[model samples]
Target: MSRNWTERDIPSQRGRVAVITGANTGLGFDTAKALAERGATVVLAVRDAEKGKKAAAKLGANADVTVQELDLAALDSVRAAAADLRGTLPKIDLLINNAGVMYPPRQTTREGFELQFGTNHLGHFAFTGLLLDLLLPVEGSRVVTVASIAHRIRAAIHFDDLQWENSYDRVAAYGQAKLANLMFSYELQRRLAPRGTTAAVAAHPGVARTELMRNSPAVVRAVFPAVAPLFTQSSERGALPILRAATDPAALGGQYYGPDGLGGYRGRPQVVASSPQSYDVAVQRRLWTVSEELTGVKFPVG
Candidate 1:
């Protein structure tokens, strides 16, 4: 509800099914571990099945965990993983779009889109759309997208060149993907509100010490070590916002959650706000339409 929200605040997830991408490490692993410990059947949906298995095995001796192969950079992989999940999971109570690429060197996905945008935004878009029907009919079902504070730094939806084909700035491109994440959640919430069963919420880890920063610039990479202890929190703590967005009874559609300290850097989870551009309904709708067109995956809901 306020500061100090932790895994202990998570309700009994007795029969819920959760599918978390990039669950092999960092925030995703912590999220999956917490949900599994709370009695949910958690699927560690990851690009690397071997790492996923390792991560699943560490959850607990008795945790209900499964490893599903999902490569967010590859559209075919997304479809294949979604098809497998469709056959395996009857209903998914939580869908955490937790996996993402941060500041990697310029690269393109197998689909020829920029790697970060393709993996971070469009892949989850297609996966969620493909699997949304399972959640739509279930009460309390939620989709919690993990965005980042970087979304506010320098982010925008580049409708003219969504793939960053003309020019590329890894930082701004990452921002675009993160911004798209929030916009997607907001727009999806608008669509889900009328559906009467599912809700879409967004969250950020607020600069936790995670492997997600491995691709950052050399200076940031060099400086992070010295400042980490002073500035960053652990991945376990970083995961609280996501856990709250997923399980907190009062968390509502379109709500965004993040840390509550030091410009949202390191503290307990709380309901936070995102950038003004992230709330633009027109832009959200446009991105949604373009996403559907690009990914060839359409949501079952309006």
Candidate 2:
């Protein structure tokens, strides 16, 4: 993130509209708070209505925030939410695909896609495409995708079995989903760069103390708790790169950012690079093709 930029520097967002998934807590909540505080009319798209409403209320009694029920794992929910948002929001300045599940004891989404991959990758993929119409015409419109360094552990996209039914390993499956997120961000950027309809950028919150890992098994959480204090950063700080990517004039499409120090676990946000696997054009293309087929959503053909 630009060193000089902060909530104090966020310019007026008076009439802007933003939609953030999983805005009930963690990175998503903090991100929503920052934007809403800047005067943006933020829609906290969440799976649970009560939690979303409570979180939005916490932002401020009169904060320009609304709670919308959106379950990413359910395409029907996503479609309905998109339609609702398009009607309510004339334009979308930012779509933060921040909601996701991680490291759960092998489960499946309502659609039967592996829970992690389904929620983290395909969910956002379809959501963005469906919401693109609202986003494309807005000046300075952007779609900020949150990926993770764990993407490096993904062994390719697993073309033959994306659902991972044959060999379902939780961590690898999660990594594959994250990798798909990066590829989608870059590919979307490439496709939209020429016309400048919008930009797609990716950012990772380096090992923040957020609830991203709360779904993990108790044993795993305890093991990591040993060194958690030494490294984990706050969720608000972790949202820096995403806030920067969404609003910073200098942020470019397809660029990825992360923490700048200590193995990228925590520090000021800066432009960062992913592992070589994330740069594979073929894998990215294949992932996009498969995602389109699986989600039954197509990008705008402008």
Candidate 3:
């Protein structure tokens, strides 16, 4: 593998199908573009169908790109989208759980889950579980989840009040959600390893200039633009880690990919380590159980 891996290093994706959430813009759009350019049939699973269509249009007529309605904030929408895909597609080569919320105000999903936790973690959990069978039988199938550096900042699985019913701190909620994304990937990989057909991997964009941070604190939103050029990379560059995780033949289950720069802010993609707490097997299992209970979705692997 190249030390400074970029989109040029991606392997051929011909004849494969990639389903990416939040594929309308930002890192997700870049990932979809790269795969489509490499001959993969890309499905831009997004909350807004119009935006998704516009995004697919940007990929040009030569690209085999389609749109699927998938609002992670609502379990009903996740189920419907999964069902639609399962009904249409015979198999899926890549399932990228990439859509997410950042520092939004105190809010909840349709199912009453905290906005970040519900959409970022639990939504993907249900969606993945509901669609795992499609990837399980296919050779070299992968479930590439996008996590974040926030997993290491003020993050923990607060089992006592998982939904922040009593108190709400947007930053902590986002951290917990991102951390859960990592934990879900690791735990899912552990379960899929015995099967040896589908692999689960995680990646993070570092500090990419994207709309995900639109809801960030006012100070950050105000100051981020001026310093963004120095501190952040383009969405295309930020998508490298995710593209690698989804396409790199050398990538293995339970592995993570992120930027190679200082503090993982910007650079080419490389294998990276997540926070220590994300490796806790006990917590991972517990979170899985809780997710299943909350979403009523169970994986075929276990």
Best by lDDT: 3
Question: Each model's C-alpha lDDT?
Answer: 0.94, 0.87, 0.95
Model 2 residue runs over 4 Å out of place are 1-5, 217-219
TM-score of each: 0.98, 0.96, 0.99
Q: Local error of candidate 2 at 75, Å? A: 0.9
**Of 1 and 3, which scores higher on lDDT?**
3
Give me the displacement of residue 202 in model 2, in angstroms: 0.5
Residue lDDT tens for model 2, 13-84: 778898999999999999999888888999999999999989988999879999889988889998998889
For candidate 1, the per-residue lDDT at 54 reads 91
Candidate 3 lDDT, 193-224, residue by residue in tens: 99999999999999999989889999998999
Evaluated at residue 50, the lDDT of candidate 2 is 97
Predict model 2's lDDT versus the native.
0.87
Q: Is candidate 1 or candidate 2 better by TM-score?
A: 1
TM-score quality measure for candidate 3: 0.99
Stretches off by above 4 angstroms in model 3 are: none
